[model samples]
Target: MPFDEPSQIPRPPRRVAPDDRPVADRLADIRARIDKAATIARRAPAAVTLIAVSKTHPAAAIEPLLTAGQRDFGENRVAEAQEKWPALRERFPDTRLHLIGQLQSNKARDAVALADAIHAVDRSSLVTALSRAMEQEDRRPDCFLQVNIGDEPQKGGCALPDLPALLAEARGADLPVAGLMCLPPAGLEAAPYFALLAKIARDHGLVGLSMGMSDDYETAVTLGATHVRVGSALFGARA
Candidate 1:
């Protein structure tokens, strides 16, 4: 039997599902909060870049946000990013991927390939590893030197006093030291830490500053953060 001609082919009507709470509603709520935060900081809303941290959340959860026009997403673990990036890239090619976790030297190549920016380059060895990896891959991802502004030994960042020298070395290596990144101590106000980071970046002529997470992003913006990493607030608590 001959198949039906193109003009005679039958088509099924598209089915549209309804939800009590639209995705835009959630995004509106988030945008409102971000607006309030920006206003409180006296910062132009456009100055603060919100990076939707999507670590541990499945791609399905993120698909809605992507559909809602959120283009920046951050992940903490290299292994998780390595696993998630390929599929997410296929699905959302325009989405920007950021590595906001401590990066080990061994994972440098994969991180360079998958991340649009690495927000956690803490030490010279890691930078060297990244430089070598980028050379091998013939790629260079934007990088932020994580600074231990709180001076917390437990944190994975370079000490504050060590920053200038590190920045010089990173620049010398021909790596793009995009800016500074930091994690303030728990229960501590983030403004001072953010201010300090901004000053350091200015002194070195670096422009990018990746600071603040969900808890202290407003404070960070007030202190001149160009980028803020927000996770749980954007995507419900991650297990």
Candidate 2:
């Protein structure tokens, strides 16, 4: 059977073994799901970039996936990524690191120096900081303007009412605004939020839609996600 077919996507077994599968196997499983979702959406699988979120995972646990040929990785903290990725990248120099957490303005310089993509450009201060950092370092990582899709107060995304102005500020500062990122409120259906983000990206003529996580990535791909940030599914449950 063709692997990209919806029917070919693997389903959970009736009585599964423990989650002791190697990282390579997990990566393959996620890739197959992405392919299946893309095919169902009539999109080329290559259009979706799978970012294996490596936050809180030690380098030892991440190396197997690296050896398995996974290149795009995501991290949550600047200091943690600074500490672990330097040595890992020296060994595997092609790894693309994504800063997937809320970034403080003070760490903009470090983030610009470290990440190939910044997925949390939510505020004007961050936009100013990142623009200056990019000029000083002469490096421009792709940036995603995160949106608070569900109007959740606790999240680190630009409120919907303020997004246009924020996007304008980011553009005025010469930040490479690639697209939008969002985290839908937990325990709620994510498709609406994913669709909303995709529409917003289209309305603004932006191309990237960095949405989805381990549980909802398949849905995300079908809804036009260009990048899926999956962690637990790829690295296994963190202790």
lDDT per residue, candidate 2, 19-78, as tens digits? 678778888999999999999999999999999999999999899999999999999999
Clash statistics: count for each candidate: 0, 0
Candidate 2 has which clashing residue pairs, if any? Answer: none
The alpha-carbon deviation from the true structure for residue 121 of candidate 2, after best TM-score superposition, in angstroms, is 0.3
Q: Please tell me which predicted candidate would have the highest lDDT against the true structure.
A: 2
Candidate 2 lDDT score at position 131: 96
lDDT (CA) per prediction: 0.80, 0.90
Per-residue error (Å), model 1, residue 230: 0.6
TM-scores of all predicted structures: 0.86, 0.92
Candidate 2: C-alpha RMSD to true structure equals: 6.9
Query: 1-239 in candidate 1: lDDT tens per residue?
Result: 11111122222342223334665575666566667777887877786678989999888888888889888889999898777778878878998999999988999998988888999998999989999999998888899999887778899998877877788889999998889998877665566677778887887898888998766776677778889897766675555
Worst 10 residues of 1 by lDDT: 1-10
Question: What's the lDDT for candidate 2?
Answer: 0.90
